[model samples]
Target chain A: MMRRILSRPFAPVLALAGLLTSLAVAAPIYNAGGGAPRAVFLELPARLPEPEVALRADPLPSGRWRLTLAARHFRFTDICVLEAEAVPLGHAHIVHDGVKLAAAYAPIVDIGPLPPGRHRIEAVLRAQDHRAILGRGGLIKGAVVIEVPERAGGV
Target chain B: MLRVTSSSLKSGAAALIIFATAPPASGHEAWLLTPSEIEALALTPVPFVFASVAVLGPAAGLALLAAAVALALEGRWATIEERASPWLRGLVPSLGAAVLRVGLAAMLLLAATGGLPRHGTAPWTQSTLLVPDMQLSLAPGWDILIVVQVALALILLLGIGTRLAGGVLVLLSGLGLWVFGAEFLSYAPHFAAPGLMLMVIGGGAWSADALMRHDAPDPLTGPAAEALWRGARILVGAGFVYLAVAYKLTQPTLLIAILDHGDFPRFGMTYDVIALIMTGVEIVCGALLVMGRLVRPVALVILGAISFLAVVLGETPLFHANLYGALFVFALAGARAPGPRPSRAAWRMA
Candidate 1:
């Protein structure tokens, strides 16, 4: 039995099996305890009242629209520009019809005047790293829909 | 009986991980997500995740033992490897290097033109240096990078001034870090790895440089060659480790969210479980590359996973074109020095 197990073919096959195990099982466990210092997403628990946003869009004279946001429990700040900490203080991402339009650092931002149709604008709360912040049930976001009427409306 | 049980458990764990590794992926970087999509991800909830130390400890031990056995088995099959690996070790490295150079050219061209624009930006509207996340528009006066990228693409495509191009890539990665800050962390090491490899293995047979400088000497014979080749492997491995740790392990919600957003095929694993498995596999693969064990196979597996993610995520493969090129080089050249290693062709180079 020993001789058979020690044979070249058998030994090589055994080694290959061992290698596969090592790659699949061991390495992942080794690093389970270690993680990057900062987390991009910040999860606010149910205990903290969920933050909310309400968006208002005004057609500007320059074929653009200015957006104003009203918040209930969140504060907007640009202090966490370089890092993604699990902090609620950061900018909001302005999303236009499922496309991220811009980062609203303050209470207001400027977006497009649209191409003359109905449009949906959403404001989602974000952490310092641009990661969406999650509240009690889901994403802390608010939306508003408006009609562009015509391309010449804002212009 | 306990010993038998332990042995069985080891084999079972190995088999289980193997089964899980198949078709295991979520998606590549979803840096272009809009606000609504991000919100949906924020709402995406993971049902359950399995992280019992009881299972992990034994399996991890078995794997460590296996790695040791594999290391011991390395280079023991010189006769078989000498005959079997000539094609893999000889023809493929040069060919793979060329492919990397060409792939890099394509990526650089895309960066200059913003060809793979996603979500918010239209094609040709967003000009980033390397990734969509690194938009050059964020920094004024850096529009010069467009011309620089175009020039680099042309140079890389032709395979001339290849080493100089690699240096430029390294410099650009450093510059991106300075300009974009830590946001560039996700991309810096990955870009630097390819640049370093290009510097070491410049313009293989398929380049204008090779054609023009006929009979160009192989750079593999020097002592520095070994170190440079190893450097590329280490960098790629480190990139994997960093990504797994920063994005997946540390911020698992992000990975779970990405999986949800991409609607990745679960294969019966929960999104969180899938995230855990992916995280673990990346760590193992990356560690293998760094340790110079079973490099070709590990690289091939990583490539397959990346390709799968691209298809499932409905994104252009160009999103990870740079990684594709770097992995191809690794799969072909492997962890061994190309030829005449001061040491034996470490582990057959296959």
Candidate 2:
């Protein structure tokens, strides 16, 4: 039986089958818990461009403020292909006074209901996975200050 | 009994690994089609499918070992080829052309009506160019280009001036690529396939060009025609399958992530669920092409899906190439053979 299995014709097939069987039974191993696959991470190389972000703010009568964002050397995609996270394509995250706001899909976004005071707002472009889009120029960021009047039924 | 069961289990696992890795890694680059975009996806968690495949190395080895035994048992390669030749010849050009032609028309219509980037203002369209000044000026030109493209697609769909329309599409795509630079060169295969098909067939038998010239010889009659037609259908099918499995199934992170970008009309389904459905649709379309069943309509639907995807995700060069090629093929090879449709031809052919 061993001789028959070791023959040229059966050897390759046996080897292939053996390998496949092992693959089916073995569990996946990773260096980090729930981290990226090793092969995928291996393919990633450093290729960065100077991506810059700018912000423009306007107040609307409907008790909400609109924020417009622009970026140079970057583009945004509605869907983030995690495999494409290294690329300079992602949406912007709005930061109001150090608190994280919603993600901005387009160049313009509307933000809301502020008390009578001045507030600082910042916009940062993030990668597909919600990480910051950073290059040699550092993180892509823009900031602005806006004033809002108190509501009619203010506390 | 236990030994036998354990052995079978191992064999199954080995085969699984081999099957999983057989397809090439070409599809994962949907996002990384350009050099600059490579880093964007590299940092994210590996797509689940890819990650799974990556860990199947040992099984892959055993699968390779087992393939030899299977192949030996299968035997008589010449006999198999002889049996398949007639089927291949019958299916290639005739059925293949019909499917491609119809697919092309639907895709053209979609592009003309704004399913894809007929203009230069879109991110994928403009991303090809690094020059900000040139990007600004390209928008007006793109507007004109869209109109012209629409006219050509309509003409092609009607089977009028098929060759001319195809030639122009090739030129337009080429010009676009030239402007976009080498970053998009890899997409040439998809872009050029249709133009080459049109040029080869000129105007198909059912086309307006043929009707105008009664004496025109049938372009798909030669022995080589069989291979050509079969190749076309297979190419389209393979492309679809690749996109469905590789891009959608393997790289679903992007699709899921995009859900947060905007409100999509999902008809009560979540975007993630919708994405799976779309993937299933793509696979079905691809399978239809491979089986040469409902070629025209399925191709058209596939084109529409591609168009919709292009619009939402932005048309990458890959998307552009697929759209361009599908249009060319559709114009040349209409939905079905140019006579009373045979109801069970695809089944018979299979």
Candidate 3:
């Protein structure tokens, strides 16, 4: 009888049916759920390096002011920073006259034509998740004063 | 007079203040980096050349290091196992299985609770859908699905109707994959494999099914049950091994990036070397699990590591799910229950 069952073409079908029946009788549990979102990481200033930023702006031949930024106590990874936490490894967000400019990954960045007046350019060190890197005092930021001289033709 | 204790206390207080008030900073987006990007990061020259060297050696070097450790401990491992077996063998397995069942049931209940804002969390509410296109929508027959999910979990937890629960789980998981498309396959295959395995084994001797059988002899104790257990083990083991290789070994740049993100490099240790060491441990543990060598110990170690990562990397629900799966593997491997002979009705069809 066993041989007959094994030899039959419907053996696969029978086996599947039995397997399904057994499973049905013995109910099991699985994981398909999600969990609440929480803060990714916390960086204490004691463990953090005193991040410093220096900014330089030079008039380019193309008429745009080329801004060069040198950051100390920070690292950059083009890798996604939203999920993982790394200390001191993050990008810099540039701000001009309190208006948010752009997030920069590289040291050298180009700034478009600024109005001929005194302006403040700030480089703020940010964590990988885009939160501003903070010290006990306040945000880790550096500012440089730039004077955009009036062009050859006065308005 | 300046005392050493006073100086230490001052520094400790300063450190405490720093940690207590520090605001959490945003980190990287959750995603896997490509192999090439990782390679580039590993080879990138930095001022800390020595640190880079520590992290940047060939994979063969790691393999050799592992082999050396194994060879050194070869003689003692057997003796250690012999000594530990009597005490460690009996209690851990059964307890681990019960925990696994409860954990799995809880996760299922959470999933069954349906999508957000009702679920009120990303991992729970958004877990049922992946990408915008799969269109499993938050509404519709979610009520029915929740009812089924709760009923099945209760049956499985009681161990009274495990086979039925397993069948339903298999069907549900299958349907989930079909609806969610192949993208979500990587997320929950571990849950599905164990469901089928339990169906074959009839929830072992500790279950209500066993109590109902009441010395009638468990048909699952036969060769078929053994095969099912082995299959489940292999599936889990293989899944972990693949992750170890793909995420840790082949593309350690990503690991380095994560370590760097954690500010691990500040302690004068090379993140690259740290990455390599972590990868090596993952590979060795994963391989041991796959080969069914020292299964209980390996599972425990992997479980510990994963739990730690879940906390350190971020406590996502997915990580919690993985933890439950590891616990199940531990139960399956450590269990040594006596079961009665198979009932004729079970094998009647054959």
Candidate 4:
């Protein structure tokens, strides 16, 4: 029955117009036009020395996990700028279980006494412009999966 | 802090802004998440976003300027069309139809097979529809929809039941909207425009439909048919405009990210500058299409641009199979109609 109606040439015109209209009517409202947020990425230029990074997480006493970032040819800077840096260094995006947890300005990061379960933590090397720095093998970063055993008091 | 308010959306255009605002920045995000990016993108806070004054002001200005220039060129092109006889265009009359059929067929085939996934992912694993976002997994009765989609693709290929296939194309576009809602906005118009075009033109000279027809064909000549074709062209143009604004202008991060991902070489220019220029050119091309001015050139430019992206990004040509065919028709057929065509917007104003 639907096919029969669709077979008509006019049906498509109406349907498409209707769809377009519907979309325009239901746009997400943002306080934009004055200032809409734009993501700016600093692309690593060709022939640049690629920086590499590795992660090592140690469980601290207070249920806080301390992560030590071991990086090569890349410096972890405290400079919070939106421009491309002179060298491949800015900060790191510490992702906890798939969500962006925090931007680590320095090498070491202390993450939460996360809920008692397994957590997949990833640290991606980011340039000054917040782009995940890319190397030959792919994103110049490191990741590790950790399991948080249930504490005595279920805390 | 980005403020998202539903109260701002009193009309459809307002909603379009949001729809345009919320696209993921690039294939890089997809790489990070391993193809879960599309799902993640729908949960937009700040992904590939750019509706800022810096970008939109210039992009919108470029579109307006392009429309003005195209309106001017429209007169000269019409004169050239009246005088110069292009032998390849409509010479066979069915060649355009045949080309369109084959192009759409290939796209549908790729989509049905997931031969052309939107993300740089394993084929047949993610995409099973015309565009990347319209995942078959998201739709209800997708199992049935896939069969219908594939069947339509086959029919369009064979040119056995073309008008019916075109009709199905329209329905499929509608179905995308029904299932995916606003997310489908970028793709729906492009698909439906061609679908309507196919319906109007039928399967040109080489199609099985043409073979079956005993009487003289009357598909491309009439005033109504010509108007529909013009309308279809405008719709295609508008789709381009929407994409240019929504993706490139508003959400420039994605474009930049993709360019960066491919290590798109800059001729001593920053990625931002290059991104701005690309956005401007796309707006111009889309505006020309909408104005029906310099259509052949516009079509060629679009064809070249999409082809370049596919090659540079290492994507399959079949990803934009529909566009290739539609552009081919425009390049060959030109914008002139067989009969008395509608006047330009300027002429009407005069």
Say which candidate scores most in TM-score.
Answer: 1
lDDT per residue for candidate 3 within B1-350, as digits (tens), equals 12333332442343233223322211122222222232234333322211232323334345435534553463476476545444433322244345555666666665554332111124444323212112244333545566677777687677767766766776776665655443334333466656655565455456777678773123255666665565556556655544443344333445566665444433465675566556556645544444344456656767777666656654454435635654544543442221333234433422
How far off is residue B223 in model 1, in Å?
1.2
The best-first sequence of candidates by DockQ reads 1, 2, 4, 3
Question: What TM-score, computed on C-alpha atoms, does each candidate reach?
Answer: 0.70, 0.44, 0.49, 0.60
Best by lDDT: 1
How would the docking of model 2 be graded?
A: incorrect
lDDT of 4 by residue, B1-350 (tens): 01111111222243265455554323222343321232222233322223344444444455455545555576677676544434435432477777778888877777777776654347878546676545576454666776787788789877877877887898888887777665576777788878877777777767777678852243556776677677778778877767765666555545665677677779898777687678667756764565455777788888998888778877776657778877877776666453222234423433
Clashing residue pair totals per candidate (backbone < 3 A): 0, 44, 45, 6
lDDT at B75 for candidate 4?
63
For chain B alone, what TM-score does every candidate structure achieve against the true structure? 0.80, 0.44, 0.63, 0.77
Per-residue lDDT of model 2, residues A49-71, tens digit only? 56788888876767667898878
Task: State residue B206's C-alpha deviation in candidate 1, in Å.
Answer: 1.7
**Fnat by candidate, in order:** 0.13, 0.16, 0.02, 0.07
Q: Please provide TM-scores computed only on chain A for all of the candidate models, following their numbering.
A: 0.69, 0.63, 0.65, 0.67
The lDDT values for all models are 0.67, 0.49, 0.49, 0.62
The reply for model 3, stretches above 4 Å from the true place, is A1-155, B1-58, B64-89, B92-94, B114-135, B138-148, B170-177, B200-219, B250-253, B260-268, B314-318, B328-350
For model 3, state the Cα shift of residue B76 in Å.
4.6
- Write one digit per residue (lDDT tens) for candidate 2, span B226-269: 44444456556645554554445555545444433334467787
- Best-matching candidate per DockQ: 1
